[model samples]
Target chain A: MLEGTMTSTTEITHLTFDVLVDLLRKIFVRHGVSETTAAILADNCARAERDGSFSHGIFRVPGYISTLKSGWVDGKAQPVIEDDGAALIRVDARNGFTLAASALARPTLLERAREQGVGVLAIRNSHHFSALWPDVEPFADEGLVALSFVNSMAVVVPPGGKKAIFGTNPVAFAAPRAGQPPYVFDQSSSAIANGDVQIAAREGHSLREGAGVDRDGNPTTDPRAVLDGGALLPFGGYKGASIALMVEILAAALTGGNFSREVDWSQHPGAQTPCTGQLFIVIDPARGGNGHFAERVAEICDLTREAGQERLPSDRRFRTRAETARTGIPIKAKDMALLQELVSE
Target chain B: MLEGTMTSTTEITHLTFDVLVDLLRKIFVRHGVSETTAAILADNCARAERDGSFSHGIFRVPGYISTLKSGWVDGKAQPVIEDDGAALIRVDARNGFTLAASALARPTLLERAREQGVGVLAIRNSHHFSALWPDVEPFADEGLVALSFVNSMAVVVPPGGKKAIFGTNPVAFAAPRAGQPPYVFDQSSSAIANGDVQIAAREGHSLREGAGVDRDGNPTTDPRAVLDGGALLPFGGYKGASIALMVEILAAALTGGNFSREVDWSQHPGAQTPCTGQLFIVIDPARGGNGHFAERVAEICDLTREAGQERLPSDRRFRTRAETARTGIPIKAKDMALLQELVSE
Candidate 1:
């Protein structure tokens, strides 16, 4: 499957889910990860690809490998869960990938929520490289409302500041329906995600107004400026900034982890994983005694859908998931070759 | 305090907290509320005024009086709290003001959170006619992170629709610091709160771009259009819309209360309070063993305040609170007259 020379602007080829996951597994295992850990991480990548999150899929594999190679992430370390309280589960990630810790923590968290109406899971010392929706969607599938917050490396500037203060902290919420797919939404507090800005720079696309600012705090629509010393502004101005601060406190401060400002990237060079944090809160709606929870959710979906050309949140993602499931996921030819090369190395 | 005529831009007169609370207590008493319940509601009004939330202060007293007169809100009713689970307190508000119910449920809620690391209070069959911050700030004062969501009358439209399908649902969050006042924020999901739009319409002021749309779904900056046969748009487009939907589910549906769509305004012709719902979640930072939570919060505050010309979320509110406490709450003469008239009636 020799696709042409690796170029930034290359045509894409379809890859089966099995084949893509297999390649990711091989690449992770080649970097000295346990086969089980590699499989878990690879599953996360496959889900990202299946959901059309190309940036978080194969695009992030190299970064994960780099972190592992630099000894910034433990490939074989197991997560330890502590019952901090009746409704709280604190997960020590043991300096490994967050996916492993989250995988180990979710079932217990859900069980606690089911028994106690609400449960909170705080993960510390983990490297979260995957999209947040996957972490919360499973709880929603079990008929619970789930919210997830994660603080990453600081790349987003505060509302009026020139320097980066908060990470592109993301908040995700998911709620289940009776028969339909759950209502799920995952969004970064930044005006635009760094991954999207990088994609625009690579594709020669101009950003919309207010996407980011130059180094001197002046507004700019140039994606390259946002990537080079410039910082992405929060969405909706100060409102987004406030939410980011909340995430930083809840994920980093409350979880006994490093804040975005505390993550020193220079100490470990390229792809060095930061000691990050994640918080997941799951609530059982049944405890509220609202017997028709599913019907109520469906009604909301109907009202939102009937309100003009608007689509329900995560509708597009579910559609893409269906499409990718039928037709194979399309990967850039260059990315396909890079994955193979990483495994071979 | 007879300072001005009842004009659109009437000057206001200062009313001492004692006088204002006394007036509110008398009005509620005249309307047949129990003295304790009246005192609770009066305290809520005073806090709203002290915090400079005039829309939720005396400005809403007439509505409360009207609802009581219309026999929609049972002013003498008491809230009942049920321990649905280890971490959940379900409050049946008994068709009364939510403030009373919240006051009744708060102690248990705080205790539950302290014991279990998290607690949820779901309030049902209540008229939550005031600001959301008051519901969460008390928790924050007790060294807990708090979040509250409430759904009200349908006045805001969905993202693409011309008609209002959702209320200007509000979400509030607060976290405590050692020396500083708790970091607090209460924001409506709409581009602007309905009261602000009403004030702008009365003052003949144009709204900011993307505030709302006219009857035909054309974007308009005219506040009158938004108030008359038009609908307010959600902030940040679909992201705000999604949050509004979450509030609807969590507040109304999950609490076995009425959604904005389910509220039949025609049935309750004038000032009859619809049974609204509120949900509050509190988390104890001690659960995660994060001892420096206050310092971490302060660091975030410094970063945001130092970044630019931006004020911290509740800084202005705290200042207003201090000013109100010192110089007394300023109330429009006409509103003062109305309150007196209601009490006399």
Candidate 2:
């Protein structure tokens, strides 16, 4: 199916956002995904690609198809929401994609946040294989603050540890700003993201120092070594390690999901997605009685840039999104061929 | 007053926790702190010292006295809690210590978390100078998960920024465990905390590499340079910078408090504490329908330790607490003398 194909030809094709989403939707449906779930995932991936989040965009499509074929994740499963009439909402994703669960729970989460000034959404038995910014940005666009945590497969070790006991756990946050797009950031607790390491290995590049260790638990800068039985180190030493541990507790333990170390998908040889859980905390800034919350966020962001911080998190993505909107999303010809191939496979 | 006096005499005095608290309370009362506020502040400081958090312990008593004398903080001010009958509670600290506000709002926060499955406490116009772990550990002891954020004075610069735009912002988390004390951690987003830098400067030690920059924005390992006119860098480059920005938004902007950069104390010379904001998010883990929530937390923590991470965030602090309970808190002779002098003055 032309997986990981990069041709010498510099041919590029431009596709409108809608067109890309529709094409990806077709690909998902062709591989046993339900129409509703396909639509949500397609839009998520398309948005990431348009915003220049290449690792989570079409680059992950092959993995999704393989996992579906291996029956590692239920492509047609429906998420069940448990409403205790409180600020906390729980969702059993039935081993489906996390996006489906999140999409179904968004309305209830928003209502609770508006009513109670805060809300928590916990989803378990789900697969989250996309960028986290998309999971949270919508809440910010609606003028609420949102934070999310999700744990992936175990590919990272605790600081000074030999075994991989943690995932490339990520934390995401979004807040509204005055007269501008929302401020958003999604960061991995690991020194480097697993996707970046995979990309570097594919492109024959060495990793930055302190990023990961070899199979023997010795520090190395080789992406290939990290991919082959090695593991990543938490960023900023013990501080980041603490954050990674926090994410595990918030996302897995609190959500009644599997810890990264417990994801036993070896039976499904082609599975690429980690069957874990996700947690979200949403808050209404108006509850603080601060009518100027958005303005203050904008003020601080501007001051940061003025202080010589050339770019803020999601700055480049927003810029890329704007450019992509004006001129369609650019895709390599080889990647386009792969998408076409998947539709009829 | 014998401030900053470290005599060559090695004589140390062991004081029981209550005795130390009483002495500190007298000193606070002598410095214009109200009786109730003094009790709270004294207990907080005493706990820090007992837990081996020297930077936030009695070492900060002089700064507290100096700020009070400068009329920078309202020692007698009462915190007012605004309950919207939702999951969010707002506290106007009236320029008092954040510990007082947190103490006053604890009951309401706990009630809301029980009723709504989640609760948020936003405290504005507050000075949070003590360690954050104390603010969250109590909630965890009640079998709830708690997370907190606070912004101090702007001593940390954004990544690649010449000017200091963020505080030594800290995020603390705590969760219940089945067979041990609450899992807790409080860490600053900066490469080095402001108090640590102060202690290093006083003790004649160099800062760690990549910790701070001098007045001209040149990297320096001298702690004195970091204190004079220079700034500290965020840990882990841009990722830590993002966390610091999130803290500002949560603690200051959402709480209707001053941003870190807006803390202007020029008129109140000798004022050490920053009058800023603090935020807390508490959740009832039982709401997720995870009957074994505490057990799961204990499991993950055990796995982390077994993976070769010998020391967790609060490991040493808990050990120190146990040891101090039997041996009493040891204080240098000079520090004891200073405390005695403050009580008389």
- Candidate number achieving the greatest lDDT relative to the actual structure: 2
lDDT of 2 at A189: 95
Model 2 C-alpha lDDT per residue in residues A259-282, reported as the tens digit of each score? 999999999989999999999999
**Docking quality band of candidate 1, CAPRI definitions:** medium
Which candidate number would show the highest TM-score if scored against the true structure? Answer: 2
Model 1 has a DockQ score of 0.66
Instruction: Please provide TM-scores, in order, for all candidate models, with all chains considered together.
Output: 0.95, 0.97
Give lDDT: candidate 2, residue A124.
95
In candidate 2 the C-alpha lDDT for residue A203 amounts to 91
How many clashes (backbone N, Cα, C below 3 Å) per candidate? 0, 0
Q: Candidate 1 residues A1-345, lDDT tens each?
A: 533222223587777777778888989999989888899999889889878887688778878888887777789989999885479889899888888988888778888898889999999998888888888888888889999999998788887788888888999998888789998988898888877887799899989998898878889999998888888898877778888889998898788777887787565656645678999989998885767888888888788778763788788889999997777787877887898799899
Q: Pick out the ten consecutive residues of candidate 2 chain A with the lowest summed lDDT.
A: A1-10
Stretches of candidate 2 above 4 Å error? A1-10, B1-10
lDDT tens per residue, model 2, B1-345: 233322234687778888889899999998999999999999999999999999999999999999999999999999999997999999999999999999999999999999999999999999888999999999999999999999999899998899998999999999999989989999999998899999999999998899999998899999999889999999999999999999999999999988999999999999999999999999999985778999999999999999989999999999999998888888988888898889999
